[model samples]
Target: MTRRVLPYRTPSENVISAEDWHLVTPDGDIAAPEALPDWDYRMNLRLRRVVNVDLDRARTESGLPADAPLLLSAVWTATGSNLSGPAQHLRLPRAGTVPMKIDFELSGTNLGGLLLLDTALVLAERRPDARPASPRRAGSILWSDRRALRLQGDAPQFPMAVIDFSLTSFPDNAAWHLQISGSLESATMGALLLLVNERNTVTATAFANAAKPRQIDRLVLSAVYADAARLMVEHALSHEDFSEESDYPDDSLGATMLILFDRLFPDQSITDMRLRQRQSPSLFASDLQAAVTIFEVS
Candidate 1:
């Protein structure tokens, strides 16, 4: 029998929250950043660790209520590079909007997908509010790594919500290109475990698929950042070595990056994300010290 998935995003819950938001125009036209109605996000990531996978007890995700809602969601999968095209094509989750106008589009960045998203210019800034986001309290199986989580706030004092999801290297859905998928499935935590173990192997037989092992762990994280500027600084510093082509092949830039990140994080677990400022005094001179948060989950 075919397995079923769940709706990753809920109405009342949020994937990531910013307590104080100043939606800005790209050209800096508007002083205050109003919530954007047209936008989309996608993640081409793979799970790193596994705690469990119970196929028989799978559950699906659903919509959220007025009090709480699912602001973001992603579907992950990896498959045979041989049987596929140059990059993985992902099917998007059934997108919903708020203020009834915020439209979105998500495409996995397997290789060329990143280039496509860069064209849209998705803007995300970190907000450090006092209160933690509550989804489980509202009833939802929100899972995320600290490295991939952030807070959304009402102003700047206290967070109105929390973030609890990240994209691991999952396979892209084939139907996304033509918009032909009948419906989006609600993936379970257990099904997620199975994905982590797949490793996106493209040439494996059915028996070989069963032999794969899963690597994933679930843990709640509490982290902090002074502001979005500080976080951006951290990110710039971390990416200083992003273009190093010495360790990878000349043709494989994106794949090389994925491998590089995995290597940097031997533990294979991302938690408690933060932006680090440059060392004080001489070393901190210029823009080197004021880099943004060092994070990349593509």
Candidate 2:
């Protein structure tokens, strides 16, 4: 009999209770920065982070039910270089809206890592009668990390209506191309990981088949980007894959990226390849951080 993997479930009850979620850096320091800014080049060799969002305006524009609890999801994935310091967590306010201050620490110089940010909101409903309870409440039992030997106990009475907001999804299923190019003289090496889907694969394959094999680097880059973007979109849709216990390249976005890269450079053997899902906790069910990987090539 084939083994069936269980789908991870997100906690919904008492989501607005204090300590339900938090903002922290990789080192577990509570983050209180303003906001993560879009890609910035002005910082030059130093790490840069910033964000400009009016939560008050966003809430008013949302037109959601007044009693619904508001949750904000933030994701940061590292690309090009595997530095092993990406963090993801949700924020829920006891009352009112989540704090707009988004803290991201990317200190140090000569940094050659690419970081991507994804943000969204989640609205959940709580049963007013049930008092909010902590995740590890008294009389509550949980399966151990061993996944065996059930510990029987009472289930928390707090019930909730949860909602999911697919990250990386846009209005009208439209495709987006966000690119920035600059001229800087240096000999730096890094790897690129991309997510592709059926649509992007078809489009990229068509373009690759039509273009000459010896086309300029610019054209080659565009083709690769197109294919990878499609794969990324598909991977995002299959978010459950990222929840798997093993985040190896073959099981994650890296597998699809390899296939596309082969089309881009059939003769070259890409070295030090990897595909990583930057997230916290094995069972934390939140699309707070996007899937990203960083590696290098000789």
Candidate 3:
């Protein structure tokens, strides 16, 4: 593996040691695996890890002052949603070995695809009088590491919520609704939501067991996915601005829809599909049903 060359001195690789991340579950905490096949928007992730830093050796190797302020921090990034933010931060001891514990609670709505965890040790404050080859700038990295966890491997990979339909304008008996709002330029996470009616126990239960779905639950989920895809495609088709030539920001709603459209209608152009939908609405619906392969057994 190639290593990044820093202009300033850095500590040895052994200065910081981190344990594998643990996934906190209701039963107990377990070592996080490479992937979570059943992870969904309704599930929030709780993770924890322990790290030990040899501060004395780190400072000496990096030519930092004896009283230098160092910081240990963790940050998280979700590739699907294109969202990222700080997770945890702690001040390192001025001298001696320091042990730090990191706990991260990530919301499901803000996460999708790959979940990346970044941990780093940095100079917390600027030091102008430090040695010439020493780290002198604030936030100068001394050591860092990254870990990744795959969340899901399918479509409709958006945020979701379960609530009582009776409390809203939607029909009380509606099993679920896919809500799409905002312009295509908006972030996909903020533009789409899958709302399952809590009173619709069948639909709600299907999602609750999505991670380990039974045969019946699988059928229910497949139906839900097909319907959700239909709604998403129709919504995209309704917007004239959505086209193959249009440039959209990465992770934007328009970008997401463009990808979905390509997957659903591989060889068909947007103009042809739009014309077909307008000429024969019924036939278009059939075509979409076939495209989604609704309720097909896997």
Candidate 4:
């Protein structure tokens, strides 16, 4: 059946919370591409975030062209916890010109207005002529699994597949790691790990060619339980269509929460986890750390 389609527009409301990173300082900015402070010459800055995938549904609805070789004009903004009045919009390419990639930066500065963070991204603008870039190149990492999973009955359960991730500066713990766990109610169903970062950017997103979420397990310092829970609950159920659903906590919310809780606190068990969420995270590896372990839910 042909799904309903609508013209996409920028979302009227946004807060830059979940997927956002910290700030900038005399030393350096959190999300900026700039390196860590010399500490001798500069004081460590606060936090300046670069929300990875801006999955702004309205914009996705309005901006992207309907057919192949789609040209999408987008705005990437970096807001301060300080609440500075304006955001920096990267200069986009002119209509006819195309870069080797869509590369841009989120720069921050210190007391003297010294540059703190400068998050540079070489994103690929989806075009008929262009080949695909890995998810890490397009945006943030969700979950990456080389192996498949079969949920066993157990606690302290490892995820059948794993959701790997990171914080602002690679190699360090900008935020805590999120450990996830999921279950398959029956033999007929499929298994997935839905990772979410709502408080951040909702405008920039990259989906795999297969249309499944990519995995990014190579980043972050450590994996913890609470972070895992948050990733799961805030997630939305999605389809390639991009215009069918209303936004929110959602129908599968209770069930998703239950699955997370059961995996975290396996003393409780569930049979069904089939409501829906917003988006799915895919595979990713950090430049900082090469190998992180994947968790499975028994």
Best by TM-score: 3
Scanning candidate 2 in windows of ten residues, the lowest lDDT window is: 142-151
Candidate 4's C-alpha runs over 4 A off are: 1-72, 75-96, 104-256, 265-298
Q: Please give, for residues 124-204, the per-residue lDDT of candidate 2 as tens digits.
A: 343344233311121121111101111111110011111121244533232323221111111111222222222444433
- Please give the lDDT score at residue 262 for candidate 4: 44
Per-residue lDDT tens digits for candidate 4, residues 13-58, read 2311123344444565444333332321112223433332233332
Candidate 1 per-residue lDDT, tens place, 1-298, comes to 2222333432222322322212233354232223222221122222121112111111122222222322222222212010112121211123332221112222222211112110000112222321233223322343321121111111111111111113332234211010111111111111111111122222112213222312211000001111322332333235544332434322132332333334443343222121212334244322322222222111
RMSD of 1: 24.2
lDDT of 1 at 67: 29
Candidates ranked by lDDT:
3, 2, 4, 1
- The lDDT values for all models are 0.23, 0.30, 0.88, 0.26
TM-score of each: 0.15, 0.23, 0.74, 0.18
Ten residues in a row with the worst lDDT in model 4? Answer: 141-150
Backbone clash tally for model 3?
0
TM-score of candidate 2 against the unseen true structure: 0.23
Write model 3 residue lDDT over 1-298, tens digit each, in one string. Answer: 2457999999989998898899999899999999998786767899999999999999999998789999998999987777899998899878998789998799888897678999899999999898999999999999988999988545577988999999999999999999998888887777888999999999999998976788889899989999989888888889998899989886678888888898889989998889989999999989988988888866
